[model samples]
Target: MTVPPEPEDRGTLTISPSVVRKIAQHAADRVDGTTRAERRIAGLGLGTHGASAKVGGEGNDVDPVLDVALHYPAPVRRIVGDLRARVTEEVERITSYQVRDISVTVSALLPDIAPRVR
Candidate 1:
C-alpha cells in the first residue's frame, strides 16, 4: 500500500469561540439580578466551552460583540433590557474593547418559586 502524505502544519494562532462567550456570560451574571441559566444558546449556536482570541488589529482596536440569551423569573422585557446594558458595561470594562452590540434574547420566563422558611 502506498503511504499517505503527511498533513502540513500551519502555525495559525486560533482561539476557540468559548472564551469570549464565557467572559460575556460571567460579566452578565455579575449584574445584580441577572443569571446565566443555560450553558449554550440554541438558536445562536454558541458553544458552552470555547475560547476567542484577537487575530490582529492594532491591538484590540476593533469593537467586539457578545450575543446573549437570558432566562428571567419575571418581566422578560425589563430583564432583557437590563442584561444588555450590564453585559455591554462589564465586557467593555474588563476587555477595554468597545461593544459593537449586545443582543439579548429572552429564552424563558421562569416562575419565582420560593422556599419555605423553616
Candidate 2:
C-alpha cells in the first residue's frame, strides 16, 4: 500500500458565511464609540443590541451588511468610516478573503453612560 499523507496535511479549510459575519461584527464592536444597545418591543424588553453582519458573495469576495449602534454626541460620520475600515481589515485578515463592499446601518444612538465614583 502507498503511504498516506500526514494528518495535518489532508484537510481542507473552510470559512462559512456565518463565521465571516461574526468576525466582522466582533471587529466592528471593538472600535471606539461602538456600543451595544438595549432592545425593546412595544414597551417590552427584548434584549441588548450588538453589532451584526450579513456576509455574502462568491469565492473569496465577501459582501457584509452591518447593523451597529453608536454613542450619542459622537462624530457619526467619522466613527462609521472607522467601523467600515476596521471591519474590512479584520474580515480579510482573518479569512484571507476580499471584502468587496460593506453596508452599514446605524440602528440606534445611545447615551454614553459612566459609572459614578464615590
Candidate 3:
C-alpha cells in the first residue's frame, strides 16, 4: 500500500485510519513475540470492513501509525524491544508501505504473583 509521489493537480487519496489499524493488528499478530492484547475501539471508528482507498495511480504507499498494547511475561524491556522489531518488519514486509511509526503501549504485565490467603 505504498503511495507514489504524485503531481499536485492529482489529489492524494489516503487510506482510512481504521484500515491502518487492522493492518497493524494483523501484522503485529503475525510476529512471534507479539499479540493483539487490547484494542481501544472506543471513538476509534474502526469499522468491520477495514480501510481502503484509490489513489490517482498505482503503488499506493501505506502510511500507518499504530498504537499497540503488547503483553510480555517478564523482562519487559527486552521482550518489548524484540516484539517491536518483529512487528515493524512484518508490517513493512506484508503491506509494502512505509510505516510512519509503531507505538508500543505497555498495557499490563503478566507475572505470576503469589496469591494472598487470609
Candidate 4:
C-alpha cells in the first residue's frame, strides 16, 4: 500500500507511531488464542497485557514488529501465521502504508483456565 503524498502546496501528511501501534495490536488480538504482551522486560515486576508495535523503514514502506502472547493448547505455528497476515493486511489497509516486513515474537504462553461458576 502506498500513502498518497499531500499536494505540494498543502504540505506533507504524517502518521503517528501510536496509531500504527494500535493498528498492529488490534490486528494481532483478532487472531484466536492470541493476546498482546505488555511492553516490559521479561521477569520484571511490570505486568503483561497489551502488545507492542514498532514501525520502521523508509518512505511509505513500514515494517512492524509485534510482541504478543499465545494461550496454551493452541497451535503455535498456525496462530503466528494468522497473526502475521492479519497484522500486515490491517495495518496496510488502515494506514495506507506498505508493510515491508512483519516480525512477530511470542513473549509468553498463557495457560488455559476454566471459567468460575457463580
Candidate 5:
C-alpha cells in the first residue's frame, strides 16, 4: 500500500492492488459494451471471474492494465477509449494516486442473442 503526500498533511493513506482491481472491474461493468468474464483452468483448478487489473509503478504513480470482455456489435475504439477513461478516473479518485497509463485488452467478445419472434 502507498499513499501520496498532500499539502494539508491530513494523514497517510494506503491502497492495495486488490482495491485497484476491484475499482477497475466496477468501472468496466459500468460500460455498456463491456462484460467481465471468468477465466478458468480446469486442470489447474484455478480461475478468476470478472475484470483483472495489473498495477505497476512505484508509490504515487500507478499504471493499470485491464483485461475485459466486450459484447459483440460494439465499436472497439469507442468502447476501449471510454473504458480507459472511466477506469483511470475511478481508480485515481478512490486511491488518490496518479494514473499514468491504462492498458485495455479484450479477452473475449460475447455474442448478442436476440429474442425469438414467432
Candidate 6:
C-alpha cells in the first residue's frame, strides 16, 4: 500500500542562489536602457552589451545586485527604479521567495557612440 497526498500542506521547496541570480538577470535584460560591459579574452574584447546580476539568499529570502552599463543621455534614476521592481517581481513570482532588497551598481557610462536597437 502507498501513502496518499495531503491536501493542506507538504514539504518545502528550496530555490538555489544561482537560480535566483539568473532570474534577476533575465528581468534586468528585459528593461530598456540596460547595457552590458565588454568581456576581454586574451586582450581581445568581445561580448554584447548587456547586464549582469548577482543574488544572495538566506532561507526563503533573496537580495540581488545588478551591474548595468549606461548609454549616455539615458535617464538614470528611472532606469534603475524600473530594473529593481522588475527583478523583485520576477524572483518572487518564479521562486516564491521573498526579495530582501535590490542594489544597483552603475558599471559604466558609455558615450553615445553606437545606439543599440532593441
**For residues 20-116, what per-residue lDDT tens digits would candidate 6 score against the true structure?**
9888888998888876667778989787757787887688888898898877678999999999999989988998899999999988877656557
Task: Rank candidates, lDDT, best first.
Answer: 2, 6, 4, 5, 1, 3
**Candidate 4 per-residue lDDT over residues 94-117, each given as its tens digit:** 988888888888878888667897
lDDT of 5: 0.81
Model 4: how far residue 21 lies from native, Å: 1.4
The weakest ten consecutive residues by lDDT in model 6 span 109-118
Candidate 4, position 67, lDDT: 83
Cα shift from native, residue 103, model 4 (Å):
0.8
- Pick the lDDT winner: 2
Candidates ranked by TM-score: 2, 6, 5, 4, 1, 3
TM-scores, each model vs. reference: 0.49, 0.83, 0.46, 0.76, 0.76, 0.82
Clashes by residue pair, model 1? 16-51, 18-50, 18-51, 19-50, 19-51
Which residue pairs show collisions in model 3? 1-60, 1-61, 1-62, 2-60, 2-61, 3-60, 3-61
* Model 6, position 108: C-alpha lDDT score: 82
Query: TM-score for model 1?
Result: 0.49
List runs of model 3 lying over 4 Å from the truth. 1-15, 30-73, 112-118
lDDT of 1 by residue, 7-113 (tens): 55534443333444566666655555443443556667453421122212233433334344333445656765776677668655766655665555444444455
Report lDDT (Cα) of residue 113, candidate 1.
51
lDDT of each: 0.50, 0.92, 0.50, 0.82, 0.81, 0.83
Question: How well does candidate 4 score on lDDT at residue 118?
Answer: 55
